[model samples]
Target: MSARFVQQLPHRRERVADWFARPGAVTRLTPGAAPLTPRAAAADLAAGETVFAMPVGLSWRARHDPAAFIPGRRFADEVVNAPWRALTGWRHVHELADSRGPGGAGTVVVDRIRARVPAAALHGLFAFRHTTLAGDLAAADRLAGVLGIGAGVGREPGERLPRLTIAVTGASGTVGTALVALLGTAGHEVIRLVRGAAAGPGERRWDPEAPAADLLEGVDALVHLAGAPIAGRFTEAHLAAVRDSRVGPTRRLAEAVAAAGTPVVVSASAVGYYGADRGGEILDEDAAAGPRTEALAGIVADWEDAWAPARAAGARVALLRTGLVLAGGGGLLPPLAGLTRACLGGRLGSGRQWFPWIALDDLVDLYHRAALDPALAGPVNAVAPGGVDNAAFTRTLAEVLRRPVGPPVPAAGPALLLGRRGAAELALADQPAVPARLVSMGHVFRHPGLAGALRHELLRPAPERG
Candidate 1:
């Protein structure tokens, strides 16, 4: 049987086709929720080429049919081998064409396939594919606008960004995973610094408490993301772990990088530095940190201060004071989305408290900018331009999920579940952080508004939330 799907994007056909023709197209097209990892990619979709992957612990390989290839228009891939090969014949075709409408010139993308699998089972996958493609195109267009460049202008031959050997700690965490994938796609050499045994040449063991003296040797840049999560119930031990993990490990890594002469260091931080009780004040990068009495705020202040060694050694340091990151797998979205879908969603406590949030993709891009831009040193507030309060956040999320906004959830439930301090700090913080520096530098946010971000993160398929 055959299945077909079509999607329209606000870009010319050539531009969309060129994007698909690039080397990392498959990596980009695959959902962030997929369990698949590209093992070997075809340089281009030319005839007789193949791309291999490991999907859910199984080896998957697809071969291109020379006779089915049509330059600039279409290409077809056939599943060559699989455990289900006897039961399914998977032949997929991708086609692109130009179109015009009230929205102006654009492109129409169509995916047609003949497979033995049930059509119903294929629907969600194709829908996810289309949505992801559309989102990527939108990001590219937005980035083009940010850079003041013409959209769809292909990079000239031999024109490439300078790549560096970048070492990253906490490579398994949320932001680290996203950042590593992005860096790999951009042709940088990412050496994962892990706490476990070194798996291969790509990974090196690191002990944050006592890093190897030569750990930073030959590394052009470093990103420090190793810290205990701050989401659990705020018990005395939990709070101490948070503080200890951040302060000691950060200082150790910063000192090592500095002594090794690493050129730059990008360390993870949080908006919690601004204190959990700020009212309507507009907090920027230069804003004074929260008082010492606030546990989380004090920890963040110490975390940022730990980078002093690197800065003093002439290494540029950037502290990413990130806000609420909206993504599928983790962060504050899962619980909130769960409650919203169950029709139990509502503003927390006073709903009037400002919520500072950033899109997952935007946060990843901010990390990239921090690493590559020379002017981005010091503390940078990694939040969206406009701030939304708790009420609007709840309303937007409910509207996106087609759920009703229930009554405001008083602080009692969260406080009881996550302890008073955790509830007050995370669920009820009111800092309205603005990306003033990034804005002044002409940085663009792919999902600047809550509606778009919600749709992208919540509605998108996450078969495997990796």
Candidate 2:
């Protein structure tokens, strides 16, 4: 089969092509909803080949056609080895051209592909690619504007922003992975702070308990994201693991940042700081923390306080009080998506509890902004503006998947699995949080509404025309 897709992106042709040629462009453009995971690839398309791990332990390898690589015009790649290559051949060509329509000063992206994959299957993939490209370009532009840099929207010839060297912990985690790629593609240098010995020029050894005083030397900013997963039974051991991983380590890192005099710090926090059961109350950054009795509430309070040393040293610190992050590849979405696909999706508990959530991309963008924008300080509520109830979220997911909702999952079900408090604080939390600070700062969410966000991350295709 052969297909061609074109989109008029509101960006200069050179800028769009430059984005595609950047280090993390492939990682950024790969569809999250796809089953295949990228195993290894060249830093940039011009470098060489890309490999993806497929199901059943198979691999898909594609080589970039160097002869066809035109710096700001076109590039092509072909699948040389894959489980399905014997059945069909595959080649894709990407072209960027100046928009021709009257008053149109943007780039027109053209994608042409030939493969045995069905047109119906290819449609959604390409549609997702185009949409992702557009969103990423917009995000880059916004970041430039936020930082008072050039190279976005309106720019003079050869004008660009100077890149910063950012240090990040938890670089392999979902959020960190996305944020690193976003930063790399946007022309910033990212240093992954590994717990073990440094791996490459892009990494540094970090002992969380007692980080070296010079660990953050020459780093423009630091994003702290290392913490234990909090999705298990809320036993004493599990709770201790979560708290111990965060509170002490965060303080140690904060001290290191203070000593190093890193100008900015963005640390991970949680919405649970406000108590899991603040029903109907719209909490913002200014709201008081929940009582210390609640496990997460207390832990989060301590976690944010850990940044005191850095803040006291005059470093601008922003605590990310994140909500449930929605994405196809990881986080809360995968299991729910699986159950929903199996016709087992339903509301948890009372169904009236507010679900404060944010798209994975939006969360990454917020981190990007927080790292650069000196004006962004203190606690920032990282969530979508449109908070939905559990029932509404269930309905939207089912509607997007075109599946019927199964029977409601009783409160007892989660309690049995995660224990009563775990279920209560996590699965059944009712905090109606909003991004009041983000809104006040004129932050723009790429996906604000739950339905639209779900559709984009889930790769829901456009409606068919009869």
Candidate 3:
């Protein structure tokens, strides 16, 4: 049985066809909300070409038939060898033509599928596909003018890289969880370095203090994100734990990587290297580590220096000097949102301290970029463009949550909760850092501004204005 579905796009035939013919068309067309993920995109509609993909829990490969391909007119992908191949007759043909609606400028797209699957069951998939295609096209058109790069610039699309074996130390943490999910979906094999006994193919027991040289023998890259959480009531023991978790573990990992001859190592750092008192300085990656009196500053300096072994062993090293990450699940947003919901959300201390923030998505992308971009070596500031002050951050959060802004909280409150030094350094600290290297390298941000970031992280509707 076969069925066809068609939709009109407010674009010319050539325009729509050109987009479909681009490198990243499949990735752009894949809905973000869907569980289906593209591991490799079809570079062209050549016969026998296959697009590797994964559907949540299964691997899939969609093979193209040369006989059915008509450049700028139609192309079809038949299930060559996929989990879905067990189903009878599965082939999807994509067609595009100029609409004859007097203007002759509009494009009509048709999806003809021959499958035993019911149209009722497959309707949602096509709907999602069409909607994603239209939305991506519209977004490209809107950003074309300001970016100076018209929809002409093609996206790389999907995980074009060959499969790699990656070992991640903090595979259970916030950033780790997100990164692992992406890598797995992209068809990369991830070996999690667990402290517990290894129980599976993708698990390995790691003792940072005494790592085996052969532990990472065949691993292509290592991402070490395991560290004690920085946000807490800082105490002597807590500070020691923080320093121990970062510096010693990093040193051991670097040593192991050196012995194992791993090609690359991406270790985490923090913008706290700038210290808590660099008033009004627009710090960049070149800025020197600030006062040794500042605990975080000193720790981050050692933490970054701890990667020397990896670099000395000929492994390319990238230090991500990350900033405040705005995300829904973890990071700085949840407690702040709680405060806002309780009507206690307000500026801290003098409300003049600079706050460097990056959206969780952008941060994750930056990590991915750092791992791949060969030019990105040394310290790269992982932050968005606009550095907001504490007051602006508070106001934006309140606005996003649609809560009334409250008076500024005194320093004593945070000092008591987070310890005096921690409050002074983190809550009331002022370091205006920027992603100078990322900007120069032409990195794009998903949420560059404070308001947009808050809305995205909080999942809130756009704020109303008078």
Candidate 4:
């Protein structure tokens, strides 16, 4: 027995080939999987071409032996995972239509997948997501616009499923609130893990310091975002507060997970673990954690290590090294907003050090990506790929807000007032984490660069009265 699905697209025969022939063109979408970016299989396109792919849980190679082509009409590709299993196979079929309607413009699609799963269970698994067959077709549309092969962007239809239950600590915090919205939009049941009495509907409170395992029962995943603010002065006691806020709760949660045997666990870490090294080395996932880091870095190190119990108990662990977020509501945004409104905003310190950061929207995307991605079970930097330095960041931001950059704020002044901790974060410290793991896994970034990201996340257009 076979399943047949057809997508009707109105595009020129030449348009179909053009879309596939271009760079960054992804031919098909697989359900519960990322899009498959197909470059030409030829020299041009030759026989027996091997392409690299990191799909979902595995980073593997797919060797394509083009079996057929119809010039401007359609083409065929037979692919399989080489050196892994003879079982995995895929045939991608692309077709075009006449551009008679919609102003003589049209749609070219590369989709229609047929796979022969090696085993019965494998077949059933793929068969389940075979329902989400539109992704490949949709990527064909996006690939068209990216290379100017097509004028407009294409979007795949949305999927509606029952929400995946999610438990969040610090649901009242800015990032947590954003996470709720993001996860909620992605159809997840959000349960807030509050401290004491947030005692509302859909909330669970637990005291990590008390060491009772009530919170560990029946929850799928855990995101510990509750920690003392890294703002104000970093006194010895303040440092202890930051340490206790993260480490104590994290340790307790991990112990509970180990005892209860709950499966998925994700906790937050920081790029600060890399420490403040001004050397222009773009760190990747393989980069070892350097020893001589700062106090904040030490705290991050401890927080991540505290998850050992959960890891030992067989729960997948994710340590999110989140970057400075540029959002509207809370965080570093409020002060920047105030400055933008006053037109006195300027770059901090020397402004040459890089600031690896993500937009609030992108950060939310990271949470979703992190949760669904099972293979990602270690430290992953959640910063933008094309991160900007402080100086360029300020200028672009000012340009976006239609404001002017004033005289640069120096480190000494902030140290005198905001103290050493504030100075280190705001003025001196800089990191450019490349999000290497994400790119390798084929996660498309909506805001790749700084200016565009700020425009999308922060510099929203004023609302019209009409």
Candidate 5:
């Protein structure tokens, strides 16, 4: 099967310069090179690197192009190690077409991955599977920076910022509201999704349980963060709510977007989807779900699967498997803070289970990246790249709060004290994860490491993680 994509610039001077000039300050704006031949060097946009285009997920890599043709007018790469064997190969081609507008219009270019594989099987299996194709996508994505394209252009007097629009589901939730407030402040047009009639100026409406799907029009990007909270025990009712909260609304949103047409979809998922990574090794996106945790992990797998309609309709999708988000008001900060302050907190269980944690601010930034980055899609491990042992986590927190880290709590302590709710989570375990996909997309983490991350955001305003 084939895929076609097109992008444009207002004038010609943006893309072609001597057919290839490596995008110098003067060369990036040579002022006549319409239909610019995008530059790809030995390390820039070359063979054997991953790229995160919309159709392909965040981990999509580039295969060596036997047809690069030295100084050609395009850059292309294919998926060499796709997860599926049914698909022979997936080629990503970026071409610049001539523009009839002013300033010698040039397009950033359109990237298309045409595959020789069978569509039915690959679609049924992994629609946008591109991760294992290469080891590093960042080195390749950084190619754009070298070309002096987009942000590389710097500011030539009246430089136009890339148009950024943020679409949020559950705009009324505590976290959702925070996202809307931040996105709006960043000067982005924030579009909110509502259940009833579309009410506000920056809002749209759709109900997942409705008999008919609704319209998902004009949204360049989306963030599916709408889901009911499972605060109480995992009762049958709660389990159904948990599963449906994500899958139901997701299906409705996906179908609506299918009809109305949009570009990218970045949705939320949970680390619980990993279902207790008892295996010692870290679980990257490619890790298979273990049998013990299949039921829980299947929820995530199914949640992600529901987006197939949108994917088939040609919308890029990203599934974010977020860990324990450490925000001030939401998820876990309050209890952790209070327990430690009262000098009651200690390592839970064997203190060996891995705790994957992410700073709240970093979590927000992750959402922004998923919404804005044209390259990211598919499964992205949203936790900070580092995973600490439970003891290590407690020690780190104690050190940060200037407290002692002793008096180990037994495995049954949680069960005896707080009941099964606390015991179930503590008894189970997981391993580390790398935000490999995000880093590959050129995201510089404000909180890449832990101690510093805790010191700043938890203490003073964390310095810009730019």
Candidate 6:
């Protein structure tokens, strides 16, 4: 079977080509639901062989046809070896051309594939690819504008922003992985700070408890995402792990940044700083910390304060008071999505506690901005604007998945699993947080509504034609 998909991308042909040529482009384009996992880096996309790990211990190796590669115009790849190579064939060609017309000022992307898979079965994949491409390009454009690079300058469209060398902790985490890929595709150098010895190129050893003095040396910016996860039964050990990980390590990293005189530092924080059970109150970055009695609230407050060293040294620091992050690959969404799909999803407890949330991509973008945009400083609530209550969230998620709502989960359900205090502070917590700082800075959210955000992450059918 043969299939062709075309998309009018609002980016110059050269820009689109540059994105494809970048190291993390393939990763960004691949959907979370896709079975194939990219085993090759961006440098291996041309001429070099690329391998993909498939389910059931299968693998597919393909080679880019260097002879047919036309820079900034076209490229093609074909399966050189695979488990089904004898039973089926696979080849794909990517073509780019400048759009023509009175107001046309973009590129037309054409994807042609020859494979045994039916076009209908492949629609979701291509749709996801195009959506991701458009979003990435748009984000790059916005970043360029914010940084005052590209356009109006002599730089080519492909060079939207000056390349940056950013060092990131928690590089293997969900948010970190997405942020690193986004940065890599934007033509930035990413140095992952690993706990152990440096693994490969672009990785460096970092001791969170006592970071090396030169850890931030030569690094343009530092994104500190390392912290023990807060989700659990809220046992004494769990609480200690969460607090100890952030306060001490963050202070240590802040000192290192100050020592190295790193100009930019973006650290992870949480909206829980506002305390739990603040019903109906719209909290922004300016809101005071919730009473110290709240476990998470106290931990988050210390977490944000740990950056004092860096701030004192005059480095621009951003504390992201993040909310519930929604993504299909991991985090809060996957398990919730599974429950919703199984018709076991419903409102929790009173169903009236406010739930502040943000799309994973939006959170990544906020981090990217905080790292690059010097104007963004201090606490920034990283969440979608309109906050929803537990009941609303449950209904919206159910609607998105086209599943009926199951019976409401009684308050005791979470209390039994998380203990009374844990349930009250976590599963039953409420903080109607908003991104006032981001909004004031004219930040654009790709998915502002819960339905749309859920749809995008879950790879649901889109209204736009593919």
Best by lDDT: 2
Q: What is the lDDT of residue 166 in candidate 4?
A: 73
lDDT by residue for model 2 (17-54), tens:
77787767777877677876676766666548888878
Cα lDDT of model 5 by residue, 1-466, tens digit: 7755343434243323222223121111111111221122224444444332222342334455746634435667666455532355676566655555555344344546567755443331121111100101222223334334353352221122234565788777645754665454333677787777776576666566752343455567878888887444555676688788888778877887688677888888877666665567767777765453444566677888899989999998988888777654456656765576667678887788878888655676667666766666788888887668788888877776777775788877767643464356424456566677766656665566776555543442223357
lDDT of 4 by residue, 1-466 (tens): 1234444454444444543453223222221112332222343332455454455655344444455656666665656555344554566555555555664645544445566633332332233222112233343344333333434343222222223577888777767766665464344667888888756656877786875667756777777788887766767788788888988888888898888787777677778777666477787766656454467778888888999999998988888888887765567766775686578788888888888888765676666556655777888888888888888878877887778886788768778855776577545776667789888877666567877666544434323369
Candidates ranked by lDDT: 2, 6, 1, 3, 4, 5
TM-score of 5: 0.62
- Local accuracy by lDDT, each model: 0.79, 0.86, 0.77, 0.63, 0.58, 0.85
Off by over 4 Å in 3: 1-159, 463-466
TM-score-based ranking = 2, 6, 1, 3, 4, 5
List TM-scores for all candidates, in order: 0.81, 0.95, 0.69, 0.65, 0.62, 0.94
Q: Per-residue alpha-carbon lDDT of model 3 for 71-90, expressed as tens digits?
A: 88888998866457877568
Please identify which of the two predictions, 2 or 3, would achieve the higher lDDT against the true structure: 2
Residue pair clashes in candidate 1: 33-464
Candidate scoring better on lDDT of 2 and 4: 2
Residue 195 error for model 4, in Å?
0.8
State in Å the error of residue 41, model 3.
23
lDDT of 4: 0.63
TM-score of 4: 0.65
Candidate 6 deviant stretches above 4 angstroms: 54-60, 84-88, 101-104, 153-158, 463-466
